[model samples]
Target: MYKDLDEFITEYQHTADFWYDVGCVMASEKLSKFGSEDWQELSSIVHNRPLEWQKKLAYCLDTSCNMYELEILLSLLNTEDEELFEICIDTLRSFTTQESKQMILDNPSILNRVNDLLPKAGIVSKKMLEDFLKKLNA
Candidate 1:
């Protein structure tokens, strides 16, 4: 769907409401087997882009996306870009399952932010909280 990660990231960064249903579908397809190559490519997109551009890409991550694309979004979230972290925290809150919550909590950098924001988003179970804490401790 995308010529390359840079081209795709650039488009998403510059386009408004870029993460439409069609975009999500394409992202899902591309990320079905997201691995080292894809991660390196996406990370390069984040590494080279400016903060504002990365912020827009983060907004694209906030869309209604399938699990595969969400995982790719999470991979992008691993970037040290603070803007991406902020947007990812918000996106994680939008998901209503322990699986999504657990995924967010697995990242130490985002865990506290997600926990702080989750209450406003909705309630999370005690077991989920314990598991997340355990994951961090481990």
Candidate 2:
């Protein structure tokens, strides 16, 4: 278990296991403190990492991120990588707030892709996507 934020940064910065360990630490009982800088750093990491690392970090960010961080996740919807696109959509489903839904709706490409892909991926029911689209258009 990590003792504190600095310890986590000092030990885990720049490693293959960084995100996985960060996720574990975030989920653990240690109660790591995250400031704006920490969140920004994590967001940068998410944006810069490869698809696999982004996938792993997405799981961590999903649980810990704020709305701004969530927008970072939403941006991943534009990725041409099929697996990453699916993961972003699945993660976005949990964020049902108006802002998130609007973000999805505002992006025609993302909205169309969600309509196209969700059915094939089976991440969400077709009816649910239809309802969501209805809400967006309303």
* Residue lDDT tens for model 1, 1-138: 333544655566424454543554455455454565665566555646776555555555544544544575676666665546656544544465567656656666666654654465434443444444455445
Give the TM-score comparing model 2 with the true structure, all chains together. 0.62
Give the TM-scores of the predictions, in the order they appear: 0.46, 0.62
The TM-score leader among the candidates is 2
Candidate 2, lDDT over the whole model: 0.59
User: Can you tell me which runs of candidate 1 are displaced by over 4 Å?
Assistant: 4-48, 113-138
C-alpha local distance difference test of each model: 0.54, 0.59
What does each candidate score in C-alpha RMSD? 7.2, 6.0
Q: Judge candidate 1 at residue 103 and give its lDDT.
A: 69
**Predicted structure 1: lDDT:** 0.54
In candidate 1, position 69 carries an lDDT of 41
